[model samples]
Target: MEVETENKYLEPLFQDGSLYQNELKCDISEKISDILTTITVFGSVSIETSQPAIIYKSKKKIQAQILSAIPHHPKSIDTISISLRSKLPFPAISQSSFRGFTVSPSGFIVLSDTSQRLGIMNSCGTYDFIKKGLNSYNDITFVDDITVAASTINAIEIINLDSKLTERVISFHGICYGIRYYNGKLLCSVISKGIQMIQLSNGQITDLVKQREPENWSYLAIHDDKVYQTTSNYFVRCYTMKGEMLWEHILQQSKGVARGITVDNNGIVYIAKYNGNSIALLSPDGQRCRHLQISDTKKPWGLHFNAITNSMTVGCVNGTIELYDISYSH
Candidate 1:
């Protein structure tokens, strides 16, 4: 017997020209029978009566298609909670002026500072420094599994992690502060130029947002189709990829200046309060907020959350790097 199928063109994953990076979670407790009933158009389940019925019935309760579970979108979550796990020992750097850092999918970290070198390390205390063809590093982001792009005074350099060599350089008229990689493009903050997008393949640059007075201390993060940014004025603004501002929030004067900004797997915004000595968590809708106190340090400058391991990496202005495990509750 042959099964006939029609040729139907599938739509692009992101239909509205927006980038979506929602992580999918599997529910091992879900039974195939339940999945069938839930997916049936009329809410009916047909019995699978065949020669293998008896054998399948014996293991019906057993977990099947565990990896094929439906996606669990955290946007539907009502509340969230966080706690600091044991801090991983980050190797100390002498006379370090930390700027930013990014964590790769495999847990490797690459940190940039205002020095002539970039520090590459992991949570296990393994660390190394790359010091060739570099003047001053400001912000850094991972390009791929074994490559990273770092911004400097007036340019962005792409370097290989394994070889630790500058593969290419993307020059700019002004200083590039914060940088992030998404969907084969680099979103950058160039002083006086606002938010810009770079095409990695052809090096074409396009402006996403026009900044009247672009601040040098601004940072940005992307979640799903939205971009969250923080400015030196302690203002956090959410914008679409086309530069449409959706909502904005200004940190209370007591919370200090917002320096580092990141969005977790659940779409919650986390801002590092540099002088406030705390991390502020903003709800997805930008309506509610809570704080995570930092007793050990007061100058958090960079933040990166790893959804795979449920951990976060914090880089302080004093060159202190710490990894924290985040626990969430509904």
Candidate 2:
């Protein structure tokens, strides 16, 4: 999406005074209202808050309220403040189109681009290592501090930092998109084969979930012994390491496809919309906590969260990288 096109779609929402005011005035259930506020303020929000309340927020209007009519608890109205913080701009990590990115434990950023190049960026955002001539690298994961694994169209390539050499680790029959290293094995999404796990030591492939008729699984992440996979059909499905299906969430207004996906240590699932120029945060149980629109001109392609710095790095299709500091609590 271009800047003009994005503005054309968002202009009505920001310029229509009546429509904006009406949306702000609509009464929302207490539970949903609390969840929205909590997620907007803090990164994670609980889904257990169930009380009756009204929610209202506007950029042009200053109106806030909290009302309760329980016998012992009287109705209370208080001023609420919400602000959008400007994110810090990071130096360009790649000149070409990058499809996936990962942060190493030592703070190096490994980025893969459509030009069949994989480069590592230092903490100062300068390229420290660059390797070329690999096939379309889709996603990358760190097998260890000195070893990295990258997924290509039909195979997995293992690259060594010390030797600076690339090796074909395994070949797949389907298109590979997202990959992650978990429990000494590799968990990846193969479009025609579903989510598959490969034993790093023996190169044996195990089909965790068989692909169904209409679902196209693309990206995946691991957190708290659970695997989260995002599909091209705008759904995020959860599974156990053993292939047990847990839950699935269909993102509303997702623009028909989903892309980048990752999970925080707190079990917050972050997913990027393919062409929507937005990202959504979901709870562990598949509840929508927040939906964030990150760009007006470019689509967010890859996401990397640095727990040590409490920050997130978002890579856009236009070769723009942004760093944002995240708050864990209000």
Candidate 3:
């Protein structure tokens, strides 16, 4: 007996005229399913091999299609279908729009809303706690299981989840957009001032990278020993732990505003484009691999990668969140 195969081409619609002039396309050989998923004209699709899933925006919702029935022998993909398991309509964190989001190691989601509220969503996607009266919380990261540090305009606050007490840990004179906590230190991206490392113990500030010509960074992510930052000038740069430049890659369709950056365990960089309504993946060495369009997202802001579950959650400007099962193999 012989197995049959079919070639399927995934192409961007480009209907909104936001896609770059270079046509983005991918070819996959697989057995097509009769049950079609409704995808919108301006959505993004992420193909991952680690978990063998394809996540895309369909209409106003995001759906995950899991690929199964892989032949043990050398063969193409046979019978792709949508898995009944999915996360839809993430529990509302606030009445206002969400500006930042991060997932704790224990699987809880920390989100900041435009109305000065910080919310914690449990693994089941239900709000566990909501803390109000914050000063425009921008981004959040866990300093510990019961403690989280968040960024405001020019300050970083350490909040105790159990008691709901917020303390200003570090304050600077520049605008801070992105932050990450690691090894008792906080790495932050300050506009026009480059990246800064703050000692969590003493609240001491040290410049990691000074501002250079033509670009100011607003997003930061660290993987292994390397630190990553995305700039307002359409560039993604990598630096050593000692503040040495490694490589930089300029995005194809970025219109001078880039936000929401995260690095996977494999060192692949995923960034959200504020003006392009898209997300781009870059290789560890700064190579453009693929670009995805998120139709329902405007100015996608927060990007968080859950290493434990291999999931990526994105917060958009319209107060909605999209979660994807990111496969790291591919």
Each candidate: how many clashes? 0, 0, 4
Q: Write the per-residue lDDT of candidate 1 for residues 251-299, one digit (tens) a residue.
A: 8878778888888887889999887778888888887778888887648
Give me the overall lDDT of model 1. 0.75
- Local error of candidate 1 at residue 220 (angstroms): 1.3
Per-residue lDDT of 1-330 in model 2, one digit per residue for the tens? 697686566556554432332212333454655774553432343333222243323433332222233334221111111122333223343444667878776777787777777877766656655576558788889999988999886799988877778855688777778899998899988876788899999989999888753243377888889988888557789999889999988887545357778776567777777577776777768855467665452677677666676566677676655666665522
Query: Would you list the clashing residue pairs of candidate 3?
Result: 42-295, 43-293, 43-295, 44-293
Residue runs of model 1 more than 4 Å from their true location after superposition: 1-79, 88-96, 132-134
Winning model by TM-score: 1
Residue lDDT tens for model 3, 197-315 = 99987888999999743243377888988988888657788999899999988877534267789977667778887767777777778854567666666667778777887677777
Candidate 3, residue 195: CA error in Å?
0.6
Q: In model 1, what are the clashing residue pairs, if there are any?
A: none
lDDT of each: 0.75, 0.70, 0.70
Task: Sort by lDDT, best first.
Answer: 1, 3, 2
